[model samples]
Target chain A: MASFKQIHKEFVAALLVPSAPIPKGLVALKKPNITSRFAVYRNNVIVGLIAALKSNFPICFALVGDEFFKALAVDFIRKNPPTSPMLFEYGDEFAFFISQYSPADQLPYLADIARLEIMWRNAYHAIDAKPLDIAKIQQIDAKEHSNLTFKTHPSAAILKSNWPIYSIWQGHEDNDMVDIDLEVKQAILICRPNVDVLIANIDPAACIFYSAIMNGRTLGNAYEKAIKQDQNFDFNYCFGQLFALGLITDIAAEN
Target chain B: MSNFRLKKIPNLAGVGLKAQHYKTILQEKPKLGWFEVHPENYMGAGGPPHKYLTAIRELYPISLHGVGMSLGGPSERLDPEHLRLFKALKDRYEPWLISEHLAWSTHEGKFFNDLLPLPYTEETLNHLANHVDEMQSYMGKQVLIENPSAYLAYESSPYAETEFLDQLVKRTGCGLLLDVNNIFVSANNQGYDAYDYLDAYPVEHVEEIHLGGHSVELIEDDDLGIGKLLIDDHSSAVIDDVWDIYKKLIAKTGPKPSLIEWDGDIPEWPVLFNEAKIADGFMKKHVSTKVKS
Candidate 1:
């Protein structure tokens, strides 16, 4: 028999690569060849990880349907198996994998949908933070509003996409996306104020505004960017939505 | 950590906790011995998993059953980061009992996410002993090591599976989990007698027992030949054969904390709770008869 390390190296190598011969010295009772037996472990790894991916990216699985999703997932699993034992931490790059996958090219919005799903999952599992109280906004003086920089909640995220990711995801979610134009661009917000994660479509300008706030820009700066992007950018409404949802954790005046 | 009071899990049947059943378990607060969870599932920073687990923990004694520790891997030592996370979870949850598998899922920095088998050689035993010892010391308590269900045996393995587990207990002073279904699955898959394996197992050191279901698969290979393989899928109800063996073991050893594990194709809460109730029935029947006798 080979050394313990050598056996593991060979065993793991075979487990990952389907074509890799069964590691030496593996045997089933009364049978010299153990490929069928050994394939159980192989199948378990592939199938188990694929199941984890399926649970993690339900939208992608639903959008592409089962067969395509499984093929796509298998390819992704072969390339980027989980580095950690925590299955939730697996498949962060799955959306990128879908973007590169050729078959999913026909459904161009698929990758962004994957991104939305990832965001929703992240928001669901992200660290809990106490959302800023609505009264805190009332405490802020109008004169200091320009210097006000906002802190986003731990579970807050903004996704901007060329495809109608929000409608596509919401349609699948509610199962009623009426004649969504694939050419339309969409921006989405994912936030968990308390227990449930909330996903909703947001204005493109609000996307830029939220992005700027998350990047530590002052309220004045974020509003300027949002207004420049679209004159109709309603700072009042965006700020109200952010405050209501508890997406903003803190507001500070930049001296 | 030592100052924290460890609530002993009762000698009744428990079920593996699932996220889907959190609301029901919380609202209903069903009569159960305890609940078990994979520590890996709760390793997330914060979320519904933690929230629900916290609420449930207040109601029942929860045991941390880890599947990712790779205690039997050939690494020179266990993964320190994984150990740290395990320690953190143990601290936060303060579970009454903790257990890990005898299989290796991690090798060379990549996790396969499956409990892969190991060859039971002297060298492998020594490595596993060290890993178990390291885990016990890190956790400041005895951790239970479960026997793996095997599909293939190593040609070079010199030690019988029971002998290997017994030696591990003697070497590290850790306890055994005594997975009854795994014993049945492995015995059938490897052409050994489950009864004989049970007789040989170090049941005195067993702190817990796991009763779970397994699926049967037909392996069709022109080269390897045809055979019926039992996969420890844990998706269905526990077979009567497995239950009989479980009864036999408990009949001899008295009642131990047995968990009904159903990880795949999870059924409704009632189905899972009823499985636990069945195991509870076995525990009651055997232990009462033993006492009466």
Candidate 2:
């Protein structure tokens, strides 16, 4: 009788790699063809995992097309099987995997596009938070403005990329008519107003400002850094846009 | 009155709640007996998943069906994070029943994202039963263990599938979800008698049931195409054969909360609800017969 550990190892190995030789211990007298039988099970296992990945990363699959993506997914699954049983939570490092993959390297922006998809997914699933009320903003004294710390909405995401990720994503969307240019650099803000996740482009200065706020910087310091990056940085326009987008959810004076 | 009282799930038919129908289900307030969601989908702190689930919970009983527990693994250690999330979900939703699959999904800390089959033996049963006991203890509630739909079975299993299930329930006091489609799929794949398997099942421990659609693939060997056997793909409409088996099981087990699950290639709301309606009709018929008798 094979030991339980040996049989399990063999079973998992067989599920991942069909051609791998089954560990010597897992033998049953009636069914000597354990190899072929397990192969069928292995196929089902891979197919299921691949389908889950496809669902979780539909835009990534759409970019590469099904045939190539499925092949790539098979490779990705073998290399990095999920760390959690929840299929939705699987593929955390898929974008990073595409970044390092040789075949995917030619599409230099694929990784960033994958990141945008991840951000959209995160925004879609992030916790609901009440947007900053204009009434609350009126309560802050002009003297305390410099000491006020702004907190980004729980669902706020800032993504910067050289490629037009928003256009790329919109181009592949169902019933979308926008033409996409793969070469243009794009900076995007993804946030949820109500239940709908909205993605919009912003200048690099605003991206930096929001990134600083997200990193727990005070509004005054964030503005100073934005001004340093771009002398023409329009604080009024940027702040107004952020507020209008419902990005800032909480404000506190630095203690 | 304590609002946290464990609401007993009605012995009627329900449907797996999906994001696509969240608004409609909440707004229309369909008369669903219960709703089941994959707990992992709502593991995040605050999100649409939680918001919708909270709204829906007020109207119908909920069950947390976990897909990631990997109970059949050789290791004695269960994932603490998974346990924490399950605890959080239970606290938030106060689900009527919590359940996991009878298969292992992870090994050596890597999840395959599929419910892999287990060899039914003394060692395997002991490993799984211990995990079930641990999960029950951690959650402070009994869990329903569902049978996995396997494409192949290992010859090493000494115990029959039903017997293995019976022993697990006996050892852990856990209930069974008794997925009828999984029974049909496994029996077809292993060339076992499906009805005999059902007949041998300990129906008293079955707390809920699942009915789902499957796809059939024809196997060819030596230039001969054999009769088709089904695979539990959860991608199609529930077939007549599976429904027939479901009717039989409901007739025997009496009315229990049944869920119409269509996870892949999901149809429109009405089509999916029609499937639930079929199961609901059967449950109602059983109820009327019981009262008449």
Candidate 3:
């Protein structure tokens, strides 16, 4: 008789990887063969994990359809089982999965869409915080304003995708936008300063600036990054838009 | 958790809350005992899940049923991160009841996402009791451990299913959430009488009851396929046999807080409520008022 630890080790292997026999001493079912009965547990675990993936990656599921997505989910789950009890926490690496998956290579943008969805979920569950208003920005010391590095809201995410990820996600979510111009760069901004998960398609240059600022660069350096991305980058317009959208929550001025 | 109890639940039939019915439930606010949620679903920071749950929780007494605690995890330890989230939720919600499965869903570093079975032995029982005690102490509230539906039983098992639960209850002071459908399904798969198992059940320790649907599969090898295999999928309406078993227990124990769990192929609000009404019909038939509430 295998110890409980050995049985679990073997059982988990059978559940994930193929070709391992069920652990020993399973009560002999005279009628139903142990293989078929045991498959129920196998089926249940796989099906449940797949469902969690499906829930987290609905847009990916919709793009690929049911059968294809289920197969993809099964493959992903075997390689990357969840480490947390929270089902929502599963599938964090799915976007990368799609990127490397040979079958999904045809749709390169599929991975970015998964990234966007996961970010949306992150924003949805982010810690509740009051975003910085115009008053707080105006209160900054005038001399140190240029050295300000903004603190990102816990729910804020700035995704810079060369692929038109925003339009692709928007098309499926709201509009039936099928024939999108793939050449157009979609710099997407996601934030939940309040209850709703907000998504915006911002200028690529502004996203570069926002990313730098969120990454702890001073406003001066961030502006340079933005200008490098787009020489025509409008600092006032972009910063105004970001502040108005509540993406820039807290600002720290450097000495 | 607050030392002050919020409110008490009636020994009435309730249905597991699904997000699809959120709008209908908020608008209708139907007559139900209380709502139960897999706390994992709302583990996210803030969003529609919390919003809708808050709306419903305001109108009804909520119960938090954890699916991923892996209380009986092979490591014989609970995940600190999971425990932190569970504790945070317990503080915020102060639900009428908090519960987890007797089964383990994790091993080593990987989580399986299903209620995996455990061996019946002194070592296993001691570990489980310690885990349950830690969980209850951490939460500062009585936690109910649920009986799981087993696909196969181990031959090395020393104690009967009911006796194991009884001993665990005595050791940890944790109450039992007797899942009637699990009893029926496990009894069928293990070749035992569901009624007899319920009769031997520690009725005094049962805090809640669960009724769900199970389907039987023909033994693949049998040429006649006369041999049956029961699968507790929790899909569709609760069947007559499970209902009968539930009634038999209720007759002996009187009214207890019961829930109808239809996780698979979840139906609309009316269909689910109707299932609860069926369980309610059984509850009304057997016992009049609450006894072991």
Candidate 1 chain A: worst-modelled 10 consecutive residues by lDDT: A27-36
In candidate 2, residue B126 scores what lDDT?
Answer: 88
Give the alpha carbon lDDT tens digit for every residue of A130-188 in model 2.
88876687787777776778777888888888888777777777646356676688899
Which candidate gets the maximum DockQ versus the true structure? 1
Q: TM-score for every candidate vs. truth?
A: 0.96, 0.92, 0.91
Tens-digit lDDT string for candidate 1 (B117-235): 88999999899999999999998989999999989888888999899999999999999999999999998888789999999988899889998999988876444466678999999
iRMSD of prediction 3: 2.2
| Candidate lDDT (C-alpha), each | 0.88, 0.81, 0.84
- Candidate 1: C-alpha lDDT: 0.88
lDDT, candidate 3, B73-164, per-residue tens: 77867787788888888787778899999898988878888888888877788888988998998888999999999978777889877899
Candidate 1, A122-220: lDDT as tens digits: 898899988988788778677877788878899999898999888888788798877988888989888997898987689889989888988999888
lDDT for position B283 in model 2? 85
Report DockQ per prediction, comma-separated: 0.68, 0.47, 0.58
Q: Give me the displacement of residue B122 in model 2, in angstroms.
A: 1.5
Model 3: CAPRI class: medium
